[model samples]
Target: MKKVALIASVAMVFSLSLNAWTLGKLGDFKFEKVNDNVYVMHGPVMMPNKENGGFMNNPALIESKNGLIVIDPGGNYNVGKNVLAEVEKVSKKPVIAIFNTHKHGDHWFANKNFQEKYPNVKIYALAYMIEQAKDNAAETWYGILGSLTGNLEGTKPFAFPNSSVDHKETVVVDGQTFIMRHPAAGHTDTDILIEHVNSKTLFLGDNLMKNRFGAFDESSSIFGNIQILENVIAKKDGYKDYKLYVPGHGPSGKLHETLDPFLNYMKIIIAGAQKAYKNGMESYEIKEEVYNNLKDYHKWDDIEGQMGKHLMKAYSEVEMRDF
Candidate 1:
């Protein structure tokens, strides 16, 4: 009886230690390889809240010759630790690089953990994003996620990306090549679409969302978002053929299902906004009519709540272009 009790205690301790870094509410998630040497862990579609532990971004991993590369680790420190743990399951090699898609806290706050784990790892983001992080972006995100999750206690704004990348720059690390594309401001002025040249996969950050309505913040441009999507689809600006598309907040799939839906949504919003603006209709008055047309997006996360805000931004873009 004594021996059995001791063994049971040891097993319990092992389990507790194993999960010491576990923080997310979404249970049992692992990076699923979507393409050769490319893996993505699609996070919950819902907005960050106390239940989800501030994890609502699709963190990805890329296996290279010497080490792995991470994209958008997660929203906070605990979540970053969990992301690192998942990376270890696939490769014991140190993370050689990280690419933050934009300046959103949900996408890059976890950068803190990666830097602590791999001191030499180089984190990359758009120059604009790096600038924002250096400014008040980090502190602003810390407070935002802290309030949203209520559990982001240990996370801080300490580890902003150390390196800056630019549009159309080819970055080579660990025998892998990534082409950064930022034809225009989309999700935010800081947005960058990372194309893994080897795996033929494109990581469309918050610029493209699947089954979710992303925000059009002050820095965001709906017209610009549409132009980026159309350019990629038409293979313009060297965005040639790709096998897979990974969105910022949803599943990875081919262009038809992964990229087109959101593109179509933005198009509908802009067209409606243009027509409404010409008629001199108020944003609130036009959103309901537009919402009725967005029947297909009715099931998308937060569409109803985000509809008014999206329309206002769309109207502004139309107003800017016409007058």
Candidate 2:
């Protein structure tokens, strides 16, 4: 009798500890149900040196009558698992679709996990993203950088999208309409925008970030990104007063309100690049010259290094092309 009582007490303590662990970890995946059927999963902060926090960015979950739709599954499979666990707690509906914002690992690395779990669900992305991932399968500078920085353990092979949209496509599911618009080359060659018509929410992906400057690297075009922003702003009515804009890397906020700062930053970068290009400045020279001017901006601390890298790449790409 004494031995049985001791074992029972140990098991009870172990069970309580497990429950405490689950509750303690719940904060990491906290989500806000924005409306009747929509829940926005906020991305955690990216720890500068931590492997798991390298590319932490906002991913959204939309629960509709038809099923659940997830946007831009976080940076890796682990992050995706956390997100999935949280999602399951909120709704038992299977993930019917996953819309990848771009080809960046942060946005689409967990796509295969989603496929594995929800075998019947469709995975969607821009045709260009699929092509780029296939074309650059063996040579990804970002993947290499992540590995070096210890952001990732090693390159994990990905499963490309089976279905993709080249142009604007509308998908109606569960009494809600999602408009998927593939914008002209910004952030990446195949960036996509998702508009939840009923919720008046627009997931801008990396095209328009709230506080951070949108990155324009070798895969992106500065002029093109600016034009895309303009187009998004111009189509104000099309979005039904787009109240919430889900950025790929920051908190979701109002669309029109967040446009000015991003536009200003892009304009400044483009102007500086054009001037340097006309002056026949090399990429390194351009980087050195414009670094200070950009660093002086209000949110410079958040974007300086990343923007500097992007500007240099954009300069090289522009120099190699017309003009």
Candidate 3:
């Protein structure tokens, strides 16, 4: 009898411990304080799927005298709500402005949750991004995420950006100045480059990544990305001292540390693809060759999973070019 009772007690304790751990892990919101009033939640490096609860993207919060401004809030409704829960832990200011860095679903779908709570907050994005999210983009992803999470609770309908900015503009909110620049075709057709003037922090959205690169965006323009990257480099030169860069993924870094390596990687992709095409290689042959050759760039980040996909896309992109 005592042996059975001991086993039962152990089982009960273990069950309670597991439940506590699950709740604490899910409810926790980890954020990094980059500069004064600038807090960034560098989400899990894993992609948004069943395991991570559709959490990806470096969602940031900027507390200004006017209110809290959230950048790339996240990819799902719960993702944004959890961020808000964290915001409450730090500042009591209401979120006044929400900005979507680019058109990628990872950066914008969470707007629904924010809008439901703060309907008055001005959500900003490129006109195209806003329109798509309100229409097909978010709807398509919502279904995928639903299937992935089994229609997980807190996943809400898609929301639209209330304010669409077509031109470069500056807004002073709560005495803090923010400059928005359009990096057309850089990472995507709908990309925004935001300069948090007060903190000298540049939010590059998906335009720049650090430590490693994510999937190659087939929807974006390689040449256009190069042009915008060059422009961004020049802009970096104008800065008096080192400035912090909040990339869409990975860690925040300085321009030289983050942007320069990415520029080199982009150039290499173009050059490698063109060279493979000139070799009279068929598409299949080019993909195999490029996949193996690009493994050298693992120094930049793990390209094992993406190299095969990127090679196929790069080959087609270069094949279409006039050269």
For each candidate, give its TM-score against the true structure.
0.92, 0.79, 0.82
Steric clash pairs (candidate 2) = 66-174
Q: How would you encode candidate 1's per-residue C-alpha lDDT over 1-323 as one tens digit per residue?
A: 99999999999778756764444455667788889999998888887888788888899999998899999999988888888887887789889999999888899888888898788889999998889877877777778888878867667646888889999999999799999998568888898999999999999999889877767888889888888888889999889889999999888899888888999898889878988989998777788788999999999999977888888889888888986
Model 2 CA deviation exceeding 4 Å by range: 1-27, 45-51, 137-142, 145-157, 213-215, 236-240, 278-302, 314-322
Q: lDDT tens digits, residues 1-323, model 3? A: 99999999999767644543122254434666888889998876545566667775789999988689889888777666776676665678788988887766667778877788888989888788777667676677677667765534665546778898764678777887787777557777778788889998888887877656666565677767777667777764232233688888877877787777667777776777788788877556666555565554666545766656655666778888855
lDDT over C-alpha atoms for residue 188 of model 3: 72
Ranking, lDDT, top scorer first: 1, 3, 2
How would you encode candidate 2's per-residue C-alpha lDDT over 114-216 as one tens digit per residue?
A: 7778887777888878888778832473464366346444336665676787666887766778887776677778788888888888888878765555445
**Local distance difference test, each candidate:** 0.86, 0.68, 0.72
Model 2: lowest-lDDT 10 consecutive positions: 19-28
Q: CA shift at 26, candidate 2, in angstroms?
A: 14
Candidate 3 deviant stretches above 4 angstroms: 1-29, 147-152, 216-218, 236-242, 295-302
Clashes of 1: 0
Worst 10 residues of 3 by lDDT: 19-28
